[model samples]
Target: MSFDVICLIAEWAPAVGACRESRGADFYWDAPENPNGEDLPFAIERARRGFDFIEAGFYYEILRRRLPSRVRGKADSFFGSVYHELGPGCPEPPDDLADDVGIELAKHEMYYSMRPTTVRSVLEHARAVPWPEIEHAATSAVMPPRITRHDVRDIEHFRSIVWFHQDWLDEAARTGRGLIVLISQ
Candidate 1:
């Protein structure tokens, strides 16, 4: 049986189109300018169109899946505080609720600030941990210092182009055959 794979391309509208043209594979391009572009809908209409899905932010998925629960909890608290602060002419929270919310928001802020570094650390941990059970038993297996160092270096390189490089965008502008869709999750 042939497997259908969904590729989510964030900020790489042109390359995604090129790939769809060349490989006949589905493409989804989420970019800043066209947050709700028509690429996905058009692709669906075309007979040979392989592009299937569209989403605004791919980082959110990584953040949701790979980030630790502690970090997520902190983020939630931060959001709650923001909601409270910007309420619709509502009364202030009780002292207990305010204190709890304040602590949670602070913790969340800390986690938000350290997200990049935390991501790097988590990726390092993944590489060091053995297959099948990275969290349970394999995390304790000590890796060489060089391994951690090298992974961090690689992560830095990846951070540079997590979105499509500039050249890809220029190429897309040159070719106006396909659409680039963006959907905010």
Candidate 2:
């Protein structure tokens, strides 16, 4: 089955110890009340600042923008999963924003960070590539089982469709909890 990314926001400090025995999608320290589904905000633009698999990549670009120029380039060259999973007692997102801005993963995929490099690539490709080019390209070559390909509209949607909030993402990054992306497909 094709996979989709969802932000699995935890309510309490995640029980990472409990996650040790779980694998793949089970990597989560603890499951939220709902795992396969979560809510979406009502206001479109405000919702845009929250999580949706479609536009979250754009938010990652925003994070990449904050990095120092030199580090940004260096970080660009190194590509692997940039995940910030919860440690034993990972900090939780602000109660006010958490539910309004998180996702529940599909059974087949797990989460990771989209990071700047990936985000940059998405933005650039959106500007330059057409759907055919995407098919010819080894999109997401590094993350094989995952998707690297997107259509012209897909890129537009990424640029405009997803929602993100720097405060929430910043909290996640600062606390070593990262912008969630689905991986391990």
Candidate 3:
């Protein structure tokens, strides 16, 4: 199974609250009945500042997940923060988030983990590490002992992931907002 990461910016406190209340898997399901489904309240889609989903950011989640927890925590702070759960009070998503049970089983249950981190904290780690250093680490990061390596160390994939987060971080720093990362497999 492949993984897709959805990076969303909580432009305001209300947005952050919405992220806390939302089901991470909800973004993928937007049937005709659920007209407003694709509109994840926490995510500031193209409506505002031409900001929408960062398609490249999905790889960042995949890269982070491949690394061992030991390497993630200290070696890579920024991406590690994205991998692990953070923030003040994050609510647990409902078990049956999707109306369609089959969809829930195939998607949600397979891998639907969401977490939020304040923009300030994200910037702190991001700012501390130089871009070149981050790139170096990502390319050389070791996978978990049990994980069979594949394209986890691909350079192009690393570049895309970095570009995605760099853009998001720039926006968060400029506007002073929080971020919510949802991983779906």
lDDT of 3 by residue, 39-100 (tens): 55545432211112222233444444544555444335655443323222322222222322
Per-residue alpha-carbon lDDT of candidate 1 for residues 15-59, written as tens digits (9 for 90 to 100): 334444533222333422346764543332211111111110122
Backbone clash numbers for all candidates listed: 4, 9, 0
- lDDT winner between 1 and 3, please give it: 3
Candidate 3 residue-wise lDDT at 166: 58
Greater-lDDT candidate between 1 and 2: 2
Each candidate's TM vs. the true structure? Answer: 0.18, 0.31, 0.46
Candidate 2 lDDT over residue span 90-156, tens digit each? 2212222223225433423434333333334333423332333322222332221324444212333
Each prediction's whole-model lDDT (CA)? 0.27, 0.32, 0.43
Which 10 residues in a row give candidate 2 its minimum summed lDDT?
Answer: 40-49
Residue pairs with backbone atoms closer than 3 Å in model 3 (clashes): none
Where in model 2 is the C-alpha error above 4 Å?
10-15, 27-108, 111-150, 153-156, 161-168, 174-176, 183-185
> Can you give the lDDT of residue 158 in candidate 2?
39
Q: What's the lDDT for residue 79 in model 2?
A: 16
